[model samples]
Target: MVKKIEVEGYNALIECLKENNTGTVFVHFSGSLDENGVNWCPDCVKADPVIARNVDKAPEDSIFIHCHVGPKAYWKDQNNDFRQDPKFYLRCVPTLLRIGSPQRLQEDQCCSDDLVQMMLEETEENVTPRY
Candidate 1:
C-alpha cells in the first residue's frame, strides 16, 4: 500500500520531504481549502477526486504527499516560497510531481485519470534521472 502525508504551506512540505525523500515520492500541490473544506482553485476542486481515485495505482510503499500551498492571497504573491523555491518553482495549483525525477503533470493534466494513473504506476526504470 502507498503511504500518504498531508502538509500545509512550504515549510511543512519541505520538512515532510526531508524525512520521506526515499522510494517513489509523489508530491501534489493544491490550493488551500476554505472553512467548508472546498479548495479555492476550481481546477484543484476538479482534480482532487480524480487524484484520490487513482492514488491506489501508485507503487506499493510509495510516499504520496498532498500539500496545500496556501490561501488565495498567499499563492498570488509573486514571492511566495513555493514559487521561489528552486526545486519546485511551481507556477500553478493542482501540480503533481515525482520527487527526484522529472516526471510531472500540471494544471489541467492533473484532472486526467489516465495521466494520473500512468504517473502513479510508472516504475523507476522508466524514469530518467535528473542531472
Candidate 2:
C-alpha cells in the first residue's frame, strides 16, 4: 500500500516535500473545495479515483502527496506559487510529478490507468524524468 499524505495550501505542501527528501515522492496538485465539499476542477475530480487505484504501484518506501490548491479563484491566479515555481511549472490542475524527477503526467494523461501505473513503477535505470 502507498503511504498517502494529503495536504492543503502551499506551505504544507512545501513542508511535506522537505520531509520526504529521499525515496520515491509522488506529488499530485489538485483543486480543493471549501466547507461545502465541492471541487473547483472537474478534471481533478476525474483523476482522483484513477490515482487512488494505482497508488499501490509506487516504488517501495515511496510517499504520495495530494496537494490541494484551494478554490478556483486562488488557482486561476497567474501568480500562484504552485504555478509560478519553475520546478513545478504547473499549468493545470491534476498534475502528477515525481519529486526531483522528470516523470510527470498532467491533464488528460492523469486519467489513464496504464500511464499512471507506469509512472508509479518507473525506476531510475528504466525511465528518466521528462523535465
Per-model tally of clashing residue pairs = 0, 3
* Tens-place lDDT digits, model 1, residues 55-91: 9899999999999999999999999999998788789
TM per candidate comes to 0.96, 0.93
Over 1-131, each residue of candidate 2 has an lDDT whose tens digit, in order, gives 56899999888999888887777789988899767787779999899889888988998688999999887898999999998887788989899998787789998999999999999998867766464
Could you tell me which residue pairs clash in candidate 1?
none
Candidate with top lDDT is 1
Off by over 4 Å in 1: none
Q: Which clashing pairs does model 2 show? A: 102-129, 102-130, 103-129
- Quote the RMSD, in angstroms, for model 1: 0.9
State in Å the error of residue 46, model 2.
0.6
Off by over 4 Å in 2: 129-131
Worst 10 residues of 2 by lDDT: 122-131
